[model samples]
Target: MLLVRPPGVYRAQEDTSLLRQVLRRRGRRGLVEGRSVLDIGSGTGALGIEAFRAGAADLTAIDLSRRSVLTSWLNSRLHGIPATVRRGDLFSPVNPHRFDLVLANPPYVPTADRPPSRHRMARCWDAGPDGRVLLDRICAGAPSALDEDGTLLVVQSGIAGEQATLDRCEEAGLVAETVARARIPFGPVLRARVPELRTRGLLGPDQVEEELVVIEARHG
Candidate 1:
């Protein structure tokens, strides 16, 4: 997909690709055909574009970054697909509107003391302390934003507590499980925080890689 990412917008990476792959597979099985789709924390709008290509009847992309909103809008136009791109916190811009599918690749990277910044690039991956800030919020709120029989797919690093996410989803009345996983080398951020993570017991002493897991939750 051709996309224009400004300085502060997140570049499409492994997590993004993982979600897209799942979408493609589900699309082929006709799960996404003509369904209403919502892409939260939309960075470059890649997932929204994929949802569009998957024959989503209605599409919406939301991001906290203004640059991301512009980039997403441009990308949707470039792809000749109709999508509502809005600059706001996750789910805020599209409240009272539920969808058949909700996709999220929220900030799950663990940061020491600082919370994620809404106006900065670090907001793309900085989750507070245990990295549950956005993930937990999404888990708690997603169920309310999904239509009956809707599905929500979220990608997060294992270090951020995969089981915690599942537990949260299940608490929200959804059946959740890890649908896909990929082991990849730690990125610069994680590499820099290895010591802190190790001290916090989130990572093993000799761990050098991180596992990305896609959690799929469905309304029961």
Candidate 2:
């Protein structure tokens, strides 16, 4: 599918594809067929578009960046998928409404530098020290935003503490497990922060790649 990612909107990366792969698997099993979906951090509306293609009945998307919101909106239209795309942080834009599935490909890159990075697209991947910035928030908020049988799928880097995310999801009243995993060589962002990742012990000194994991959570 063609997605228009303008100057500032985040370009779909491996994490996005990973999340969609897991979702497609579930869809094949009839789990995502005809279900309501909420896509957090919609970026380019990729997940939202795929959700409908996988048989989702309705779609809602949220993003913090205005450029992303517009990009997602346009992409949805271009794909002929009707989606409600809004600009806001995480779940706030869709409060009180619950869905059968919640999808997220949040920023899970750990950074030594404090937040508010001046990089043009840092918002796309710069998570604080341990990389739980958005992961923790999603773990905390997703449960409440899900229907009784709702499922949450989140993709993140292993360095961001996958176990921590699972624990938080359980604490928030969900049963969580790692559904998928893949190793990717460090990208430019990660390569530049090798020293910080080493200092924080997030990776082994010689580790040249990071594992990406997709976590699945459901109401317990």
Top of the candidates by lDDT: 1
TM-score of 2: 0.97
Global lDDT scores for all candidate models = 0.91, 0.90
Please give, for residues 147-214, the per-residue lDDT of candidate 1 as tens digits.
Answer: 99899999999999999999999999999999899999999989899898999999999999999999
TM-score of each: 0.97, 0.97
Q: For model 2, how does the per-residue alpha-carbon lDDT over 1-220 read when each residue is reduced to its tens digit?
A: 7899899888888898998898789889999898999999988999989889999999999998888899999999999988998988889888889999999998888876687473558878888888888899999999889999999999999899989999999999999999999999999999998997898788898999989999999999
Q: Give the Å shift of residue 171 in candidate 1.
A: 0.7
Q: In candidate 2, what residue range of length 10 has the lowest lDDT sum?
A: 111-120
Candidate 1, which segments miss by more than 4 Å at Cα?
Answer: none
State the TM-score for model 1.
0.97
